[model samples]
Target chain A: MDMAFDALSDASDEALLVLYGNGDPAAARSLTLRMGPLAFRVAMRMLGDRAEAEDLAQEAMLRLWKIAPEWRQGEAKVSTWLYRVVTNLATDRLRRRRGVGLDDAPEVADGAASAVERMIDADRAAALQLALDQLPARQRQAVILRHLEGLANPEIAAAMEIGVEAVESLTARGKRALAALLEGRREELGYGHD
Target chain B: MVMTDEKAKGLALDDFFAAARSDLPEPSGVFLARVLEDAEAVQAGFAAVPTAPPRAGLFARFADLVGGWPALGGMVTATLAGAWIGFVGVDRIDTISGAYFASAETLGTVNLLPDGDLLALAAE
Candidate 1:
């Protein structure tokens, strides 16, 4: 079973899509394992709400499922396609919630850390998320994709449907804005002792 | 104490990002299950869509019904020819059959009594 899962994960996304189109549960499981967390994390970082993020993730996966049968081979990587979908969905929510502001930052965990340390870390993360919320939607998306999600600039460009130069500009300006937003709050968030 | 240098600020921002990365939340079980459920639902929908079987043309069915292309053509030709014979050829053949089988005058009727040689038949 381990080997089967390993093999499934190793299969190309297109191959998995074909399997999924044929109603293979293993394919669906593999796809969820491979892309689900990424989608959720992206949505969470973009929207800063777990429930909304989960919804967006499920929506994106549902779209993927819908397109599986008509999914052309070698057209787009599954990750890229899913990232674009999540980004669009998150951007829509962001537009809808514009001026309504972000909800409270979610509780994040730091394994093997002392309780006090974990609290500080969570605060820092929350502070970052709040600051991310302040940026323009595109800038926030580009920044998160580049820094937190670790997608390369080109991949980020594809995900955002923008040029590499534009992605660079967005990330640069976003980082500067974040730095400005987060400058004085570092000590309050418990980062100075680090 | 707030360290106020560009480089120091950059380091602090990097630290925040590191913390964010480290503390990022994974999808819960319920969320994963929801995604898989959606997948199953969509796939089931796709399965439910009825696909029409490939249609065989009349000639193709006929070909299969007979034996091969040549035989199929031959069978069609034979049927048409038989129909033509029944409709047109039968009338001409009927005239020939009537002429060939027409009754001729009987050669001659044989006399049952011999002339003058017949004795007076006594009534019995």
Candidate 2:
């Protein structure tokens, strides 16, 4: 077990993708384990709904598996490609479901919690989520990729398929928009009091 | 005053986003397991299909040439010679056509007067 873990840990993303392309079942699992969190987080950040984010992440991973055989080497990192796919999927979902309220979507709890605590956390999360939901899709993606994911401008550009200057502009605009949306509710949302 | 106000607001917003990050939900282990299972099923589906193997290499093609290196070289040389001969033959045809035209002009100049007397009398 330790040996297998070590082997997986040592393998490059490209090598793992090649293995997956060659129809190795374990490689798919390993890839999902490695990329799932990032994909889910990006999707959630972009879509602001846990259920939708989960769906988008799974769909992106499924597409990744289906496309492994056609993946060309040195084009982009597997993780970057996955990010682009999830981002585009989430964007499409948002466009399709435009003008829908978050209240209508089912809420997901982090884990088992007391009724009161769950409500409090959910409300706070929901409020922040609303603010994120209000951002333009491109700005939201840019913010998630740059600030949350900590990608460099060039990397974000590559993932977003834009120029570096465009990335900088998008991130700056996204930050301004997010700040404006969250500013009024800061005290209500329990931020910056300390 | 504006710069200071903007800076403070920016810092406050950053702090707020930091707190928001903590409350973001995580995917449950069950969900993770299901995703992995789905991935496995996909891999299995792909495995059910067979793919063709890669084609032979350039070296293999070269080795398969029936005649040896000398024969191949001779074949290439013969092809080039045939092409050159065809090109030169076109030029030769053009030259023959030009000569034929010149001979036709010379024939047109031929005056076969039975005797120069009738032609001189007609001229007079």
Candidate 3:
């Protein structure tokens, strides 16, 4: 059975999950509406492919559903859990690409984004993505979770399943690597004026 | 922890991080629909029902194991007969199952209850 959305709108994500666990279909819908896009965005940024990211997002949400019945509240935010799951899934996919095309990331459909769209969005965003694609998976995860996702070092540490010190070290190294990669594109990416 | 959280607020000092935040993609409506579909599908399994009744209890299971109440009644009747014979002594057991011993000349059978007296009593 389902509860009214108006009544559940103010409920926290964890509360919605509990309601979903209690067999409320509307709670699942509410959770999907609230957290699905965040999961999709994280997956997209990690995988750089729309379709794959969507699949990963759906997979991660399925995990969320399966865990709802036993979810221990007050442990962590649902977003933090999604960050961990999506990065782990994306990292697995990236690892499989090791021998195949690790050195040469071919242009997928997401890579074929029009220059107008790229311009409409920030050039630095695209440049950062391209540079991020070069770092090893762990470094990319650390950097993305730290910088772009705006997670604190400890939260990134939790998501990456590493020590806080490791997170800091990885983030620092990743930043330096990204800087080196983006150095060549400074003029085009709107950094030359500085 | 408070120090770290405070430090975190000062994050994205880099211009690149700001740009990436601004360029966050809006999830396509189609993808949102697919996610909703997935959620509903998962929840359907959670909420769907066999509508099954409660499981049979031990006595009911034993009753079935013994071939229903009719068989149970037959077993009960045999038990009462055995108890009556045990109270009266093995020599008072019915001759139907006493064939081997009754064949001996030394052992003879007689009715424990007099048929004629019971008939006479009933008629009176």
Candidate 4:
């Protein structure tokens, strides 16, 4: 089983998916290790709750495992599909927990910082999150993929299941909104001239 | 022209992004492990459930036979079934209506004239 996991670790995402489809347990573990952190991080940023992020990540991985049998080769990157699932799940959670803002979310376990640094980081994260929250769900997802995840426009388009032009429009509008929201507070967020 | 303006906006946005990226704290190792463990548990749950092999039942097999012959076999079968049921229903209704109409006609108490003629006569 260890050797199987090692082999699966070396396999491409598509190969792992095929193995997963064959009900290989090691392949499932390898795929989870490969995608778990990414899904968790994206969920954390999108949902702003570590516990919920963990739940969403687990749910997304379970969904991927369940759908492995139906996966087609050369359709889309497994990571992109996972991101889309995590994004949609986080969006659903956000909608369900309406009127609950990120500030109200419990802080991460190791989130302690010096007073000054805490203030700065908190202000920045809060401003950025607020701007993100104001965006339409799809636009927020587009911005997160394009800007935060550093995905290319084409990849974002694929992850979003949208046209390239639509991705471009979403990111453009999202960035504009973010900039407008964060403009005057750049210095307070420690983003001013060095 | 607009090129310079776009470049300046890009630069400003990049700086803002760099700061934002730097401010994001790394997730704790414990948190990361917990996430992985949760994912593994979920995968295990799915693994525990054995998936049944795909098989067609008796009714489905019959459907396949009647549905497979030609391009329109399935459609023809469906259409014929629908038409047959409809014919049977209409036949029943016609029989009932005919019996009632005959009874009324024989009694000479029923006039089958058009409503327009009745209305014209009433007006007169």
Candidate 1 vs 3: which has more lDDT = 1
lDDT of each residue in B66-98, candidate 4, tens digit only: 664463576777899778767777556555666
- Total backbone collisions for each predicted model: 0, 0, 0, 0
Weakest lDDT window of 10 consecutive positions for candidate 3 chain A: A107-116
Q: After superposition, how far is residue A40 of candidate 3 from its true place, in Å?
A: 0.7
RMSD of each: 13.2, 13.2, 10.2, 16.6
Error of 2 at A27 (Å): 1.6
> Where in model 4 is the C-alpha error above 4 Å?
A1-5, A97-127, A191-194, B1-10, B19-124
DockQ, all candidates in order: 0.50, 0.23, 0.31, 0.13
lDDT of 4 by residue, A76-143 (tens): 89999998899999888778877765465443233322332444545555557656666667778888
Q: Could you give candidate 2's per-residue lDDT for residues B9-113 as a string of tens digits?
A: 687656545555666568767667777887788778777887787876876567457476677778779999779768878556456656977654343345666
TM-score, one value per model: 0.73, 0.67, 0.68, 0.60
Better of 2 and 4 by TM-score: 2
Check candidate 3 and list the clashing pairs. Answer: none
Tell me model 4's lDDT, rounded to 2 decimals: 0.71
Estimate the lDDT of model 3.
0.78
Q: In order, what lDDT does every prediction score? A: 0.81, 0.74, 0.78, 0.71
- Compose the digit string of candidate 3's lDDT tens values, residues B8-96: 32232277778889999668888888888877777777767455888999988888999998998899999998788779875655454
Worst 10 residues of 4 chain B by lDDT: B102-111
Worst 10 residues of 2 chain A by lDDT: A110-119
Candidate 3 per-residue lDDT, tens place, A1-194, comes to: 34488888999988999998888878877898888888888888888778988888889988988888789999988889889998999999989877755358542234333442344336667667777787888999998898888899999989988899999999988887777776655545443332
Candidate topping DockQ:
1
